[model samples]
Target: MLIRLKELRLERGYSMTQAARKIFSHPDTYNRYEKGIREIPLDCLITLAKLYDCSLDYLAGVSDQPRKYGR
Candidate 1:
């Protein structure tokens, strides 16, 4: 899940700072999430899924499919 998050951020051309800003988090905190040092909150995960245009399942590593139907 951490790896996927970093991949998604890179795919979107976002630096850690930029991604953190988008999610209203500090860069260090967001870095912890990407580093697997912190458990991401559910709401934060949902927000990231929305921002990345991917499904929560995908972001959570529960599914490989990125998109949700009707999204």
Candidate 2:
């Protein structure tokens, strides 16, 4: 999940600050999340999924598919 987050962010050309801004989070918090130093809140996770156009399952490492629908 942590790897997925960083990969997606890099794939989309989003710096940590930009990704944080997308989810209205502090840079430090976002950095912690990306580094697996802190657990991400549910709501924040949901927002990240939306921002990355992925599913919670994917972000949580329950699924390899990023998109829920896979359309």
Give the candidate number with the greatest TM-score.
2
lDDT of each: 0.93, 0.95
- Range of the 10 consecutive residues with the lowest summed lDDT in candidate 1: 62-71
Please provide, for model 2 over 1-71, each residue's C-alpha lDDT reduced to its tens digit, 9 standing for 90 to 100: 99999999999999999999999999999999999999999999999999999999999999888997755
Instruction: Choose the strongest candidate by lDDT.
Output: 2
- In candidate 2, stretches whose alpha carbon ends up further than 4 angstroms from where it belongs are none
Q: For candidate 2, what is the lDDT?
A: 0.95
Write candidate 1's Cα lDDT for 1-71 as tens digits.
88899999999999999999999999999999999999999999988988899998898889988888675
- Cα deviation of 57, candidate 1, in Å: 0.4
Q: Give every collision pair in model 1.
A: none
Deviation in angstroms for 46 in model 1? 0.8
Misplaced by over 4 Å in model 1 are: none
